[model samples]
Target: MSNAARQQSSRTGLLAGFVLAALFMLSLFVGVIDVPFHRALADAGALELLLISRLPRTLAALLAGSGLAIAGLIMQTLTRNSYVEPSTAGTAQSAELGVLLVTLLWPSANLFAKSIVATATALLGTSVFLMTAHRLPPTQPFLVPLFGIVYGGVIGAAVTFVAWQADLLQYLSVWTNGDFSGVLRGRYELLWIGAAMLVAAWMIADRLTIMALGRDASIGLGIDYARMLQLGLVIVSVISALSTVVVGMIPFVGLVVPNIVSRLMGDNLRGTLPVVAMSGAILVLGCDILGRLIRYPYEIPVGTVMGCVGGIIFLWLLFRRPAHA
Candidate 1:
């Protein structure tokens, strides 16, 4: 990396950090109750609201964003496809199905238990996708996520069937819509697990980058491609599942953030992960803030906003494929 490139990366990182910070402040104060910054400082209720509600929600958004972004990066790298994401790959839907199962079966499962179930299901779903894909003749890399979308649709249909049978369709709707209004102190803390996963991903970023090169090449280089890939999938599953539990089914943070950052920073996982993480945090926070502002006194869910915007962005990326190829 040249000094100019380093300086440019530093500037981008700093700018992203500042944007994240500003958005966090906005998230804390921009709710329906109109808690002024000055009053929030002195008043206990306001302080409690800030600490319990706004702080946790903001933190959850940050973690969810960064975690999903890193997961997307890992997935894209592992599959060698920019379009693959947890949502696209049926992992998020599988996690939701897990949550629904736990809720229906136990009816009293704690948030931690629910998250565990979701994470396990997500991991299972990802493994199934990988195993199934391994059997098919190699095709376009994009086919992986396209297959995942079909797989997710199948799982989602099962969820709908079960929900209908159990008369819990309304409950399922809540899970699918991706609302952050449910985020509270104890409940939202589960998302911090995603923050921890991001740290773990950073530690193994170099190995992941190597593994992305192809199994034979990675093995020849003395790297255990299978283990590294499994570890990355586990991390991605856990992050995706936990985020789904906290914020419902957010779709494109993983897809969009990592793709954009990789384009800017190059595909080196070690250098790109932080930039992806920061970009994800900024995107989620900004979207959440927009959701809060656009429908004053009755906010739209951040997930809905992301889904709508992300769909458009996805289409744009799809149509604007590389010309030189």
Candidate 2:
């Protein structure tokens, strides 16, 4: 709350914004098409490509990356678990199951309908994870995410079994990997829902901060602990569901980016939210661009790249941190 702290937070936020903007520009340039930026200004074909493909792709990446990261931070704070996030905590897998079910039963359901089902499933799955974690002793901090992985695996296995039986394994497979290649104009509008949730989260950041101080503490502080916690979890669930429904599952943007931002900016969600969101967007955009250029045409999925990178980062966090974490 001091002047120096405010200035530091401002600078960190500004830096994140700069990085996000630069990456967005780079993302527009790095694509399958070989249009020069100079020519795109005047040429019809190039201009159209920029508007239809590149603009949408950039927005999708921005939304997916930032949304998941904010979701992770919210879960971490709510549960007081450093490792809990959409991917590790089974929220994304749960959403994936919802998508699979809708595809199998309805077969012709629109994206909004699928997203609705996916969001409900995700909320249920995340609530189960939190309840299970809540029942365990506080001594074991890592057990929460470990249980999440097992819980998610079981849910994922059930989904896989159904997909195999129904001969929709390929459809299920496509949603698990995160790629921006399919992000055309009409396809990616669902992601804006995720963006809206982040704004909602910012609006209630202070209440969530109070809720994070343990139920007893929040209650003693005259906060409606249960209501606020549920609201926060709902927001997280919606973000997880919409991101999965819109662009498939992109892992580690939630886990890695939020952790890094927390380390740099401290635990104040108000100060760190924008930075965390921006860092997530910047990191994903960088990875997306790398995926595009690495093979010159046939691009790697952004989820795969983030998975590999995030796995290493996760290992480092697992090994290098002190026992107190």
Candidate 3:
């Protein structure tokens, strides 16, 4: 990039960092309870509430949002399709299915076990998706994401059917709808694993960027294509699984955030990944805050708010073609 463009990108990142900081502060003070910052610092009970509930909820939102957005960017890079993400692809549904299976079979399983199973299943499901999507004509770019949606629906239906038989439909509902309302300090620490995966992605960012050039070209460029492919799948699957297991499946943050960041900053993953992560954090945290206020004393799930908002953005992206196209 030219120095001018790099300077502009730096300015944008700095501004976004400020916005994220503001939102983070706002989140701490926005719940139904009136725990003023000063009061929380002064009173032990108020401080406990802030630390145990509010802090964890906001941090979970930040981790899940940024992690899933990076996962989506990796998915797009691997598939060479902009529209696909964990929710639209089979990744999130597969993770849910894994959690359900573990719950049914080992009713006494721990969170770690469930996360492992979910990540494994997510990796499998995503692999299947890529294999099938690869068969579709690239000329018709829309076909890949459409197929992914149908594929995910099939897995989700299986989850629903099993849950229905086991009288665990409520479990299915909770897993399918993302919400941070139940987050507490101990419960949400698992999402930090997603943060670790984000670091892993950054370490291999250049390899991922090259891998996006297609298998033959990437191999010619000295990238171990198959190994990089597995690495990407592992990162995407683990993040999808952790987020789904911890807070349920929050959709569209992945799909929407990366696309917007890519549009503004261009597709060099090394340069753009931070912006994507920050944008995702801002979007999800903002939506979570909106969900809280829109209902006042009650609350809507973040998934519901994103479904409404992200759905509109997705539609706009679908019809908005480039001048070259």
How many residue pairs clash in each candidate at the backbone level?
0, 0, 0
TM-score head-to-head 1 vs 2, winner: 2
lDDT of 1 at 129: 83
Indicate which candidate wins on lDDT: 3
Summarize candidate 3's per-residue lDDT along 27-141 as a digit string, tens digits.
Answer: 9999989888779799998889899999999999999999999999999999999999999999999999999999999989888899999999999999999889878998999
lDDT of 1 by residue, 50-69 (tens): 88888888888888888888
Which 10 consecutive positions of candidate 2 have the poorest summed lDDT? 316-325
In candidate 3, list every pair of residues with a backbone clash: none
Ranking by lDDT: 3, 2, 1
What's the distance in Å from true for residue 224, model 3?
Answer: 0.4
Quote the lDDT for 234 in model 2. Answer: 91
